[model samples]
Target: MPIHEKSLIRKENLVENESLVIDGVDVSGHWSTFITGRSLTDYNDDMQDEIAALPGGENIHRCWQCGSCTNACTVNAVNPEFNPRYWIYLIRLGMEEELLRDKDIIWQCVSCNKCTYACPRDVVPEGVMKATAHWLELKGHTPKSPSTEFDEEFSGQVIKTGKIEESRVIMNFFRRTEQPLAQPWLVALIKGLAFRFPVFYLMRMGMAVVRRPRTRNWAKSRRAINEYVQEVEAANRAAVGAKGGH
Candidate 1:
């Protein structure tokens, strides 16, 4: 059997038969394949507004379909399926189903800011990616991805102490994602660094673990940030048709 252009067709929509005979005739080839068509009934008309209500999604409406975001995306270069411009178009058209197809990989963005730098309208594709990923988890469309878990762990430390302990953040991220703390590559890197600069590495590690640094007189600032975060979260939930958030 010959191959067909099945990239544009959804898996469930395609039918194939390598060798088949229909009645008294043979129809065993790529020509015997079928592609089902589907139509969406309801559209989440408020999708753009709901996403824009989030912190990083505020500029999504400014996109003019220049495709710069997708062209400059670091992830898109490796996985063409990770398209920020296409997702923005889907959001603009309220094509929720199409957007959901790429939901799982949306959180894989590395925050390299290449898309943001290349954007002519300042769409900030990085922020839109983060907002979309957050929305997916919030709406139960997907589970908390490893990247999301890492963000929460890092952010939690900063929110609590006004500073982050790198070792603690890494450990907590691995724990939350159920990954082993002693990753082979990470262990190798640490060993290499220690071997090159034993005294410097040991002193730095001890200070980071034992005497964690923090901002001085940060209680008032922390309280202010917490209150602001809560307010924004509540607003975002309400905008997205969710009831409440902590």
Candidate 2:
């Protein structure tokens, strides 16, 4: 498919002449604009497959470059550079270097799912955006995002106890991200909870923190979940050729 978004073209590839004449006709300024072509030498032919191997990217091949994803994207509405359709096109074409141009912003997707709803081919563009972000991290193009760190903390709690302790999750997340727990907002929230909440409820929360409760007979379930997580992690690393531990 042809690229219709002028913004997708690199500035260096676009040439313009201030004064020009062709066949006695003055084609100057914007009229003399031309796009320089370049050959692809670093295409990763397995890019599509690599992304598809990750969760939420399984439907990437269904995309037909309809532009619905970008048109309906919430982030794109605010930031035109966040173009889901254009990224998918680059991924399918194995244009790895071109895709890396937006590595920093690719993780800004808000998981709004508007693009997923607007897509006609069931491409699940929202998921594809997430998978692309994950692929970037796995390929070492970008560092682990805060969202991923939060997810790990949250998921670790669930897998370990079969339940979530909100306080523990927040504290661990803050620690992993190297943020202090004594922020003004957090302090205010704690004060509000202490005064507004019932004494018995507060006592229960404190006991949970001390006891670290787990679901009844959760050992089997935890084992099964841990095994599944390990398998998925291994597959993800293999798919992107990741060498080191996450």
Which candidate should be chosen as best, given TM-score against the real structure? 1
Task: Give candidate 2 misplaced runs (Cα > 4 Å).
Answer: 1-9, 15-34, 192-205
Superposed Cα deviation of residue 204, candidate 2 (Å): 5.0
What 10-residue stretch in candidate 2 is worst by lDDT? 1-10
The TM-scores, one per candidate, come to 0.84, 0.83
Please give, for residues 72-151, the per-residue lDDT of candidate 1 as tens digits: 88999999999999999999889998899888899999999999999999989999988888888778789989987887
Looking at model 1, which ten-residue stretch has the lowest summed lDDT?
1-10
lDDT computed for candidate 1? 0.87
Candidate 2: C-alpha lDDT? 0.90
Q: Distance from true position, residue 185, model 2, in Å? A: 3.1
Model 2, 1-246: lDDT tens digits are 123565877789988888889899898887777888788889999999999999999999999999999999899989998999999999999999989989999989999999989999999998999999999999989999988999999999888889998889988999999999999997888788788877976898879779986788888999999999888989899998898677
**Deviation from native of the Cα of residue 76 in model 1, angstroms:** 0.5
Q: What residue runs in model 1 are displaced by over 4 Å at the alpha carbon?
A: 1-4, 14-35, 196-200, 244-246
Our tally of clashes for model 1 stands at: 0
